[model samples]
Target: MIKITEKSECCGCNACVQRCPKQCISMKEDEQGFLYPFVDTTSCIDCGLCEKVCPILNPFDTKEPLQVLAAKNKNEDQRLKSSSGGTFILLAEHIIKQGGVVFGARFDTNWEVEHCYAETIEELEPLMRSKYVQSKIGNTYKEAEQFLKDGRLVMFVGTSCQIAGLKRFLRKEYDNLLAVDFICHGVPSPGIWRKYLEEIKSSRSEAAGKNTVLSLSLKSVPVITGINFREKQQGGYGWKKYGFVVQAKSPSKGDKNSVLLSSIFNENIFMKGFLANLYLRPSCYKCKAKNGSANSDITIADFWGIQKSHPEFDDDKGVSVVFIHTCKGKGIIKELSSRLDLIDSNLKEATLPNPVYFRSCQEPKKYSLFWNIYKKTKSVHEAVNAATKLTFIDVIKIFLRRFYNKLRRTFKMVN
Candidate 1:
């Protein structure tokens, strides 16, 4: 009975699939590579569980956070590896030390982002950093609930819709569960991601002057080691100017090559398309998971505009704006007080620049045009480039950056 007539009504949280009692619900990927629930008509029980658990249809009540603050991990190494402040790692580590399970998104060997769980400190490293694409939630909520039932502490981190789905799936609150949601700027289609990989592999094979069977079959695509969209490279980690660095494992058997794609966020095709809202899911344009209503125990996001209010905290590395929504969240922060540099801050001021926190993003006017190009060419790069256009000033800034870097190197050599 729970069918998605409109994509905007479904967040694609996969709760219906995992919560089906008859096991008749299956998640089928659409042309855009986003999974939606499909029920077998022959096995129609009409129990209404799916509809009841739908977060969008049956919303829950939530309260404003008790307090908000700006903080960063004292560990420099952790901070550098993180997209923003290392707040996620510190919180995850606390749960792991308490013998808890942590669930979040991570890129697998095939460079696909999916939700997975980790119980050890070592297992949590790959789970860190930001994966821009919408992650496939594959029965992770069921697993997290079981962990909570077993009297084990659980820390689940994801987008707001994801946390809402988990809460609905549990049907009740668990004292040991800590739900953490981030300020999401919408998710790009996984189809675009696959196409991007195909282009990269095809280009690489052509450059090598020979195509292997694996490359031809699209089986041996280069393994993505890491992806950083908010890289702190271009002078500082300011929101206006940031780097997109992607690291890939070498295709050759023993070559340990680190492929770095460092550029301003605007120059990167994927970032440009993403920021332009060219390929976001329809649900994102009218998201129901804003204004602290998702009931997440805690919320963490990049402390954008940190330099203006908290100059001392702005080290160009990263800083996190954290909101403690529940008493449990406050307790956890209190426990990690010594391990972090915390400063009390106004919630309104801290979240001023983050539009996603207050409102949904408007679809770009050229969204259809971009997708039309993608439909015809089947090229992620070509489609995104066609959809988004860089201004003349942006091009000039890019050129000046390259020239400055070259001049700096030359001067160093002369000295």
Candidate 2:
């Protein structure tokens, strides 16, 4: 029987419990709020499905394909309100409408990322946005599998490795199951995210007030809302109901909030989709779902190249990128196409991703100590700060750099 010797090794994704045909495994939480797998010897068929599906045991295949597509996401309103494009929402809508249960991330009362179920398209709003923080999956797969066994359709989505991990656990496939996984980067543990949130809340205020879930808008420097948690019907959030959201900002311009410390990014503090690509679980960085080989049928992400390649696709706000890896994925596309507007750009035309984007989850130790430090980064605010700085020292440095570049160009001309 397989047992969790070190619980920290598990993210509580519950892949192992589902893969066992004998249904021998279950997850339980410990004092530190960590979850580990426990096996039921009575249900043990010993098929080794649990071991086979462990993302640690099997890594993703990272073969790059020549084609990728920039897609016009359906449900435009939700797309504009999404952490990224609302691809997952559209997929979830169809799944739930077909009487399937959708499983994804949500926050508990303490605002920690944890697993939850969305029975309808409406319930998805809270679950759809990217949390950026590492999600705690407590027996979701085991619960989802139970739902599947009773002949209920189910749709599950998460980072590619996670989706793959879920598939490996089930050991078998059913017609009612449709899985979607994202092209992930990595996920950070909740402990690290907790530290960062405390720092933000300390520097800012407890989330309150109209038009603000995080109350980030300072009257002295009113701008876009950041990480609003208020439900939309309550009229505080702009349009969508967001829960457990993370805000990435560009550096500051001389604002009172600006730190004297140097930061990256100009003064733009924008939410650049979900930060799943950042602070990943160690197994996720070395994920085995890189290629199209996982059990997940569909892959989703932002159509990064929509601006250049599919200019006609109308991202006026946002567009979703999609990869249909299997017949099941193709079927989902057909269903979605019927309900929403969609355009196609293969993997290649969408955009040529930077080297880091392709090798996002290659390894964990590959990062330096700086990785932990970078977790504190506020991207949008940093960009704004980078753009607005003109201190006395900066003036001299700019003048020198300009003069040196001019001299070098002149010398090259003469040569």
On lDDT, the leading prediction is 1
Candidate 2, 164-262: lDDT as tens digits? 677766667878888877766556556544544554444342222222333333343322223433223222332222323334332333322321111
Against the true structure, candidate 1 reaches a TM-score of 0.87
Give candidate 2 misplaced runs (Cα > 4 Å).
1-12, 17-50, 59-68, 204-278, 314-316, 354-358, 361-415
For candidate 1, lDDT tens digit of each residue in 16-125?
A: 88898898999888887677899997997999999988999976665678999999999988887787888999999999999999999998877889999999999998
Candidate 1 stretches with Cα past 4 Å from truth are 204-223, 233-241, 249-254, 390-415
Query: What clash pairs does model 1 have?
Result: none
**How many backbone clashes does every candidate have?**
0, 48
True-vs-predicted CA distance for residue 42, candidate 2, Å: 16
